[model samples]
Target: MKIAIAGAGALGSRFGFMLQQAGNDVTLIDGWKDHVEAIRRNGLNVTINDKTFNVKIPTKYPSEVTADMKMDLIIVFTKSMQLDDMLQNIQAIITDQTSILCLLNGIGHEDIIEKYASKQNIFLGNTMWTASLVGPGHTQSFGDGSISLQNLVDGHASEAKYLAACLSEAGLNAEYTDNIHYSIYRKACVNGTMNGLCTLLDADMAAVGATRMAHKIVTTIVNEFAAVAKHENIDLDTNEIIEHVESCYDPKTIGHHYPSMHQDLIKNHRYTEIDYINGAISRKGQKYGIATPYCDFLTELIHCKEDIVLKNDPVIN
Candidate 1:
C-alpha cells in the first residue's frame, strides 16, 4: 500500500516506520522543515522500549506535494485546529479512492473528513500509543499500545474491514469495532479529565493522583462527560471511566507521563483540543437540555488560559 502520514510528528513517525517495516511504501508528509530535512539527510530514528533503530522512509514537506500523487491511504495525526488547513493543503493529493484515517484526540473529525472524501474513504479510529518527539528525526515510544477502528456510517463496513486488516498486518493490532463513537467518547472523557488537570496543576500523572482534589476534580469532570454521553445514546459507564483514570494514574502504569494537552500549553501554543473534548460534551448537553456545568466551566477556563498564553507568546498561533 502507498501510504502518506500527515503531521509526521511523534505518532505519525511511529506509524510511518511501522508501515515501512512491514514492507509497504510509506511517505511522511509534514510541515516541520527541520524534521523533514533531518530525516532526508539521515533516516527516521525510532526508540521503542529502550532500543533505538532507524527506518528508511521517504519524507516530504507539505509544499512538495504534487496534485498527481495518489496514496492508498493517508493517516491524519495533526492537531484538531490544524485539520482544516491541512486538508486544504493536501487537497490536491486526495482522490475519491484514497482512504483517510484520522486518529486525532478529539471529536467531530469524521464529519470534517467526509466533507472532502466519500464515506467509504474515511475510517474512524482511535489509538492507545504514547510517543514524544525526542529530536528532529527521532521519536520515543513509551508503552505497549494498539488501535481500534470502525466505520461510522452503515454502508462503509467493507472499507473499514479492509483498513483494519491492513493496520493489523502492519503490526498496529487494529481491531474492527461496531461502535467506534462510544470508544472515542470514552477516550475523550479520559483525556478531558486528565490533560487539563495535569496542565493546570503542573504535575505528572502520579503527582496528580496524589492530590485529594485531583480525584474530586477528575471525577466531577468525568461524571459530566458520562452524563452527556448517556444523553447522546453513547454507551459510557461512569465507574469504568473512573477506573480508567485511576489505572492511568497508577505508577505501575502511565504515572510518569504528562498529558499532551498540558505539553501544548507549556509550549505556549494558542490552541488545544479541549474544545472538541469537553466543549463537545458541553454543546451536546445544551442540545439535550442536560446541564454540564463542569464541562462548561472547564472549557471556559482552558480557553481563558489559552488567551493568556497566546497574548504572552504572540508567535504560538
Candidate 2:
C-alpha cells in the first residue's frame, strides 16, 4: 500500500517506521523542518524497550506533496489543533479512491477531515499506543497498543476492514468495529483525566495515580465525560472507562509517560488539545444542558498554563 503518515511526530513516526519495516510503501509528511531534515539526513531514530535503531523512510513537507504523489491511505496523527491546516496543505494527495484513517487524539477531527475528503473515505479510531518525541528525529516508544476503528460513513466497512487488516499485519494490533464513537469517547475520557491532570500537576501518569486524590479526580472527570457521552447517545460505562484509565497508571504500562498535552504545553510551550478533549466535552455539556464543572475547570487551567508559557517565551508568538 502507498501510505502517508501526516504529522510524523512521535506516534506518526512510530507508525510510519513499523509500516515501512513491514515492506509497505510509506512516506511521512510533517511541518517541522528540523525533524524532517533529520529524518532525511540521518534517518528516523527510534528507541523501543531500550533498543535503538534507525529506519530510513521517505518524508515530505505538506507543501512539497503534489497530486501526482497520491496515496492509497493517509493515516492522520496531527495534533487536533493542526488537523485542518494539515488537511488543507495535503489536499493535493487526497483523491476519490484515497482513504483517510485519523488516529489523532481528541474528538471532532472527522468533521474537519470530511471537508477535504469524502465522508465515505474517512475512518475514525483511537490508539492505546504511546510515544514521546525526544528530539527532532528521535522518538521513544514502548508498550503494545491496540487500534480500534470504523468507517465514518455507512457502506464503507470493507475499506475499513482492509485498512485494519493491513495495520494488524504490520503489528499495530488493529481491529475494526461498528461503534468507533464509543471507543473515541472512551479514549477521550482517558485523555481528559490523564492529559489535563498531568499537565496541571506537572507529573507523569504514575505520579498522579500515586496521589491520594487520584481516584476522586479520575472519577469526577470520567463522570462528567459519561454524562456528556450519554447525552450524545454513546453508551459509556463509567466503571469500565475508569478501570481502563486506572490500568494505565501502572508503571508497567504508560505510567512513566507524560501525556501529549503535558509535552505540548509545559515542555514545548505549544497549545494543547484541551479544546478538543475536555473543552469539547464542556461545549457538548452546555448544548445538552449538562453540567461539566470539572471539564470546564481543566479546560481553563490548561489554557491559563498556555498563556503563562507563551507570555514568558518570546520566541513563540
Candidate 3:
C-alpha cells in the first residue's frame, strides 16, 4: 500500500512510522518547515515505551507536492482548523482510486472532505491513540489504541475492510464499524469534557478529575452533548460515556497528559478545534432548538484564550 499522512504532526508521525515498518510505502506531507527539514536530514525519532529510535521516510510540504506522487490512501491528521486548507493543497495527488481516511478529532469533517473527494472514496473514523510532539521530527507515543471506521457512502464494505486489515497489520488495532457516527459522537463526548475543562482550568486530566467539582462538571457537559447528539439522531449512552471519560483520569493512564487543545493554546500559541468540537454542538443545538449553555461558554472561553496568547506573541502578532 502506498500511503500519505497529510498532517504529519505528532499523531501523523506515529502512524507513518508504523505503516512504513509494516512494509507499506508511506510518505509524510506536512506544513511545518522545521519538522519536515529535520525528518529529511535525519530520520524521524520515535519513542515507544522508553525505547527511542529513528525511521527514515519520505516527507514533503504541501506546496512541494506534485501530481506525479500517486497515493493509494491519504490519512488526514491535520488540526480541525487546517483541514480545509490541507485538502485544497493536496488535490493534485487525489486520483479516482485514491481513498481518503480522516482520523481527525471533532465533528463535521466529512462535509469539507467531500468537496475534493467523492463520498464513496471517503472514510470517517476516530481513535483513542495519543502522541506528543517532543520536538521537530520527534514524537513519543505509548499505550494501546483502537480505530473504528466506516465508509462515508454505502456499499464500500470491501474497501473499508481492506483498509482496516492494513492498519491492523501495522499494530494499529483497527476495526470496521457500521456506525462510525456513533463512535465519533462517543469520542467527542470524551473530548468535550477532558479537552475543554482541562484547557480552561490549566490542569492535567488527573488534576481535573481529583477536584471535588469534577463529577458535576463532567455530568453537566455530558448531558449537554448527549442532548445535542440525540437531536441529531445519534444515540449516545450518557452514563457509559461519562464512565469512559472519567477512567482516563487515572494517574497511570492519560492523567498526566495535556490534551491537544491545551498544547495548541498554551504551548504553541495557536488556534484550537473548539469550533469543531463543543462549538459545533452549540451550533447544532441552536438549529435543533436545544440549548447548550455549557458548550457555548466553553467555546467562547477557548477563543478568548487564543486571543490573549496570539496577540501577546511578537511573531504571531
Winner by lDDT: 2
Candidates by TM-score, descending order: 2, 3, 1
Tens digits of per-residue lDDT for model 2 on 134-240?
Answer: 99999898788999999999998998998899999999999999999999999999999999999999999999999999999899999998998887788899999
Q: After superposition, which runs of candidate 1 have C-alpha atoms over 4 Å from their true positions?
A: 268-270
- In model 3, what is the error at residue 97, expressed in angstroms? 0.3
Q: Ranking by lDDT, best first?
A: 2, 3, 1
Give one clash count per candidate, in the order shown: 0, 0, 0
Better of 2 and 3 by lDDT: 2
Better of 1 and 2 by lDDT: 2
Indicate whether candidate 1 or candidate 3 has the larger TM-score.
3
Write down the lDDT of every candidate, Cα atoms only.
Answer: 0.84, 0.92, 0.91
lDDT digits (tens) for residues 1-317 of candidate 1: 99999889888999999888888889899887878988998889999878999877899888788887889999998888888888778878899878899899988897788777878778898898777777789988777778889876788888898898988898899888998988888788778888888777778889988897877887888888878778767867888888888788877657877777876776436378888888888898898888989889888988888887777675663
State the lDDT at 136 in candidate 1: 88
Model 2: residue 39 alpha-carbon error in angstroms: 1.0
Is 1 or 2 the stronger prediction by TM-score? 2
Please report, as a residue range, the 10-residue window in candidate 3 with the lowest summed lDDT.
Answer: 262-271
Off by over 4 Å in 3: none
Instruction: Give the C-alpha miss distance for residue 257 in model 2, angstroms.
Output: 1.0
Cα RMSD to native, each candidate?
1.9, 0.9, 1.0
